[model samples]
Target: MKQVHLAAILCLGFIPYSLTACHAQNKTSQELNKSPEAANSTSETVTTPSSTQIQQAYKVNNIAEFNEPWAITPLKDGRLLVTERKGRLYLFDPETKKKTEIKGTPKVAYGGQGGLGDVALHPDFANTPWIYLSYAEQGQGGYGAVVIRGKLDLKQSTPQLTQIEKIWTQVPKFSSGQGHYGHRIVFGPDGKLWISSGERQQFDPAQDMKSNAGKIIRLNDDGSIPADNPFMNQGEIAQQVWSLGHRNPLGMAFDPKGQLWVIEMGPKGGDELNKIIKAKNYGYPLVSNGDHYDGKPIPDHSTRPEFEAPVLDWTPVISPSDLNFYTGKMFPQWQNKAIATGLSSKAIIIIDTMQQPAKEVQRLDMKARIRGAVQAQDGGIWVIEDGPQARLLKFTAL
Candidate 1:
């Protein structure tokens, strides 16, 4: 097994992950009042500033429009393949502002946070044009998240999907309204697909090896487990199990050095950014930086030295949704920095990496719930907003 060393460099002063139970506390009507700025309103106001006023040296340019876009991936041909939560995939040409919806996607359960999720092109897409997708499917018990693969038929004006096949499905198919199906997919350097599964708020299932509910699963392109998978020999352990003990992991990506990193949401506090390792357990229900909403105490990561700890974590909850590492030339200063979008904190957090572990350097408060951020082929940064009337925006140095 390959090992990556992680060391704590910059301490943000201890922000305890444990919090007092707010369950019995009366739900104040004021708590229902949404912040005017965070409220979802459809207004086409072009707020542009003098180029010189841009301090971070980047400007946001609205590139295209979509209906609740969840993820975007840049193709080798410079076009972007964007996925909408309505079980539709579209091809967006930034140069021409042309958008065409691809047909032939599997049926998706689109409602209350469950729908078409992440879409990633295969690493060898230039030759294969194979695209991978994660979405909520109505199954035996209820709705569960599923990962599938299909070929993109780009020869037509409106591209379509062909050869569609379901690769993996979360077991037990139980639905709990808003399932935390943390469906982010990425193709690793080894050509295996790494998927982050949310615990569906079931808690105990996160530690279950037989169930695939809350685990980081590694699978071949065709959705089969690699024979050499760490738990392949264990009968009860799912062959797809790469690591266990995860809650709602929304952010996942690889650095230039080939290390896999993941960010997951903690209870009330204790949102974590972890460096993923093979078969290493990340303390969840047993040990966490945060306590249960019912005020039950959970052990801290320190309590179990055997389980791996997050390299960095955020108190008060950043609600990190997506992760990307800057490898482009536009922001030379941000080279190798891990860029994460904060959904609750409404910021784009940049973590600077040294020789060992990475540390948070700056948290740029966009004042918008950033759902996804990716480095464009041209070195610019592209970000997608989280709800209805979401705009696909591009950021370039001013």
Candidate 2:
């Protein structure tokens, strides 16, 4: 297997408000206007470069470096909490150049693609000090993705997690392979929690109504099931399901218009960018633009009109890791663009979503396997790269 450092925060302590317990998801990514579909698509094709060469934009500033960092989350006070794959969470201040290891972080599997994953702040962090985390855990299945909720107390010289509790986990637990533990967690437009549960390389479960694997789920902050979920009529597994049929989904965020979008790693050449709809099936193993590793062909989305297809996809593959929509004043011209990191392509992808069938306006060559992307509180784009000694970089106007 190849070695990589994959990529975390919501710390804007604003006015405390009570959520009526009904719902939540506002994550910013690039903006795009959809108007047309061709071939097997339901809409018009987003422009593909006639020339396969990538265009570079923006210079990178090496803010700091760490060992295999997985996520980069920002607090309102401009402090960053970064998680490493080997089970360490560090609170970093880009301004102060300080790094403090956060205690009480859960132990991670650290095998293949498994390990400590995403960390996000509660949507209402001002009132509630809850912090959400997703990581690979040892259980009935050889290893499974797990989501846990906790409160991080940073009052003292040391920071640590308190009131920790499990929010979600992969059912039937064991996976034969540890390469696909997709545990990206994002809050939707509603107040509910949305989790990307990978298929665990177990193809059939992506379409299984009885399993949480390969499904996008909705949950209350306290780990309770939401009442209005689409699959609530079914058994336990289906009750929390919001959408089904996915591979290893990592990048999940809602655009300004409240539309949920996710980027999934497809087998071979079919990496996909999808607009997530409630209860929709995003044909994974059954249908994809890419095929099996052995070169076996899977039917395209056109073969199944019942399935939802990708808004855009990569043929040569970029190995997309994290997602961020630029809405800050620091990079004014980059506003409304979905900025994502490409591991294989060694570039930063900037998608122009405002145009009909969003275009890949820029691909900044970073010369490293970029793993995570986030817009920091200081209005700079922060990213973490792959491997030990990986650098946390800040990108601004050249």
Model 1 regions lying over 4 Å from their true place: 1-56, 355-357
The per-prediction tally of clashing pairs is 0, 33
In model 2, which runs have C-alpha deviations exceeding 4 angstroms? Answer: 1-57
Worst 10 residues of 1 by lDDT: 21-30
The sequence of per-residue lDDT tens digits that candidate 1 reaches over residues 272-346 is 888889988897877777667766777778789988888876655677789999998887657788899877666
User: For every model shown, what is its TM-score relative to the native structure?
Assistant: 0.86, 0.85
TM-score of 2: 0.85
* Predicted model with the maximum lDDT: 1
User: lDDT value for candidate 2?
Assistant: 0.74
Which one wins on TM-score?
1
How much does each candidate deviate from the true structure in C-alpha RMSD? Answer: 7.9, 12.7
